[model samples]
Target: MESAIPAHLTVERTRPARKSTSFRPPYPSFSARFDPSVRQVVMAYFGVQHRSATPPPVVSEALAHLASVGGGVNRERAQYVDEAGYHTTVEIRYWTDPAEFSSWLADNDFWTAWPAVPDAGFFLEVVRPTVPRFETLFSNDRLEGVAVAADGLSGEIQEHGYWGGARDRIPLAQNDLLAPIGDVSARTVGDLVTVVPNGNLCLIRSGQEWTETAGDERQMYLTEVEPVLRAGMDFLRDDGLSVGCYANRYLRVLAADGGVTDKSFGLSWWRGLEDLETWSESHPTHVAIFRAALKYLSTMGPAARLRLYHEVTVVEPDQTRFEYVGCHPRTGLLRALG
Candidate 1:
């Protein structure tokens, strides 16, 4: 769907974390995991507007109620996402009945009830929802690595971080898979994916896996073990490890039109990528070991490959500076996004 917000004010971004070109569902798409009970979605773009007098509590309450106001059966999750320097301070997003949009305004008393926040330079924020008219172009899913030991806390830890907007958690610990990547490229990306109190993101790992023969049980087991995921989490639990650039997955759940894969995506987000080094110095231990495992597995045989993608969003500036369209620095052509 075309965006309802004006073109100039919207801040668009992308990630390079998703690259699952290898392992796709045997069918065109996977079966739907969560039943589609909530059909309508609403996206709210939030800005600081009046930082001094703005009532954070009131705003918070309004957001909380917005989820249930529409009344759907599907587990409607609400998340707030923000990227530093982006025009919008926060983006409160959710899905449910479209009709409730009116109720959201009335119950919240948005008319005159908005915190007597300043009006002059309110920093101007916008909240608009737009569904993709065509299909979405990405896929996302949560694959639990090997959950070796049941800390009984894995679920809680994941929930906490998932809700907190801490996009990726490996690099801080120097995940096992980092050395091969960081050492080889250490290339920095100018993008990031952050989760707010209620936001979420996704990851992707793909490359030519060794072809399965009639009988080849001698494959590397550590990389495919289930406990590894928990191991990664445990590493995150620990404080320090080595420092290096790590890869973080980015997931944006736009309406997919089956451009990439012929399979249906699950409760996942569109794919994107991020470099751990660009934001911080170190990575968690579990992450370090985990990444290493991936690299080692890559060496074994089948060429593990998953291309990454991401986005850099900024406000519309003067038309003169509007560039990058078809203007290839090398060939100098005006080919832009269709």
Candidate 2:
């Protein structure tokens, strides 16, 4: 059976890039916006410690509970998950104001419940970066406890399961997928990932589904899984892929506690268009994933196909979220501080 790219470090944490820091390639004729086009954007990165005996499902259920209560984060997307070695990553995204968001963080009841979570005793980073675009293209930076190629493509993304939701936090199953690869600081973090900052141009495509009960097995041609497959084959292969990301039913909890289907977004590292392009074509494993994506699509019948739902963002803030965030890398993940 396939496991996460072999763990380079015995621990889950890693150090910042030691090789060399270069701007991720830049988007051609592109621009950068401080904030997404939506009301606001906030993300949290979590690294769940991987244990030889512990099951990943245990971690998944713990996150599922946090996302349901208004405890973890309050936003559009409910939750997320990514894999590296024995670690798992979680992120949340949504529409809200800073003050209200801060209030949610301050609530003591939330963190109290965090410890009981699977791998809860691990490390995490609470950060808010300058969202260069609406559809976030992510890249991982080497830091703290990790030792891997400074360049992206350290290994293949385990591409574990994902969960997310929007509008109402409804537990929508089968619409989530995670596409994670090794540390992606290679080539460029500045260029290809942030090509468009157009709020009007970006759109949130959701509700693409194929239900088993639908009974039309022959109707498998029309499905959301197509874009997901395309994302790996065409998008990741051809587009500026600085950092790879995964999907989740809900990365955050909501006030209403209602959600549906999983969602996706970017991380702090991905940038630079040129570096992204170079890795896509040169990376051996990436090429392999693309070639195999077609076969993977075959496993998911029309009902198991992907859904079409995404959010288009527009920059409304003159200043960026970095103003409020203090991030320092301890493990492979960034640790957020005041």
Candidate 3:
């Protein structure tokens, strides 16, 4: 099928030159789900490296298959390469029952097939929010991001200052409830429970316009901004900071025709709001990157083909829940509260 995406913006998928080991399931159990009304959601990141500016057939096929299955996923969106050179796609699935999602994952062919394909990479993070545990703010009336992905997640559309003002609205608790379910506290290869700081889970979704036309602005984003953002994620994942930060992912929005757009998203799991603030404000790496990005966007203005914005949702322990099935031992919230 011909893609509606213009030739300049079209990104063909590419496979790795060589093969690698298959993704082995890390978690002891794969079947876990909260009540359907609670809006259990999963963000699955699937991608492949770009070779010669075109994506491999497998990459596109895998994405289509994922979207086709539905798997209780009410909505789906995708993007090609954002700043990250990898041709990545993300699917936000809402399952009425957690088990249904688990069953789909267990039987999905892409789970086994994609990894076998040379140079393909995939990871899934499932988030289930309890009532009154989470909050969302949007700038536009359009239903986008996680709000569009699930029911009962919509919020009032507000302009820029809303994020700053949101802090006061978020309810505070004197104690943190995110502790390991069992007694173990050290990083053991197969240990189920691990100790992590008390805090809430925060999800930030923000980005801007994506034009089919490409130029210097697109080039700069891919070359400059992408790397810096990637480095910050890497630091959080590998360093094992004083506060809890389970995982972080960057995704591009994919159109209906399987073409990628300019809009990008950052999905991260944090120990709490304070830790997230520390990284955003005090962390040298993050601070420098923010400064650079500001300058870049300011210079490009309307020509940049990108508009960046963000909304944050922080869920307290009782208000948030997570489940894993067929996942690695330390994946999602399970890593901290095994």
In model 2, which runs have C-alpha deviations exceeding 4 angstroms? 1-39, 50-68, 71-93, 108-120, 126-132, 136-274, 287-305, 308-331, 334-338
Each model's lDDT comes to 0.23, 0.29, 0.47
Model number with the top lDDT: 3
Worst 10 residues of 1 by lDDT: 329-338
- Each prediction's RMSD to truth: 18.8, 18.1, 15.4
- lDDT, candidate 1, 272-294, per-residue tens: 12232222223454455446545
When 2 and 3 are scored with TM-score, the better candidate is 3
Between candidates 1 and 3, the lDDT winner: 3
The predicted structure with the larger lDDT, 1 or 2, is 2
The residue ranges of model 1 lying beyond 4 angstroms of the native Cα positions read 1-41, 44-93, 109-113, 118-338
* Model 3 TM-score (2 dp): 0.53
* Decreasing TM-score order of the candidates: 3, 2, 1
Better of 2 and 3 by lDDT: 3
Judged by lDDT against the true structure, how good is candidate 3? Answer: 0.47
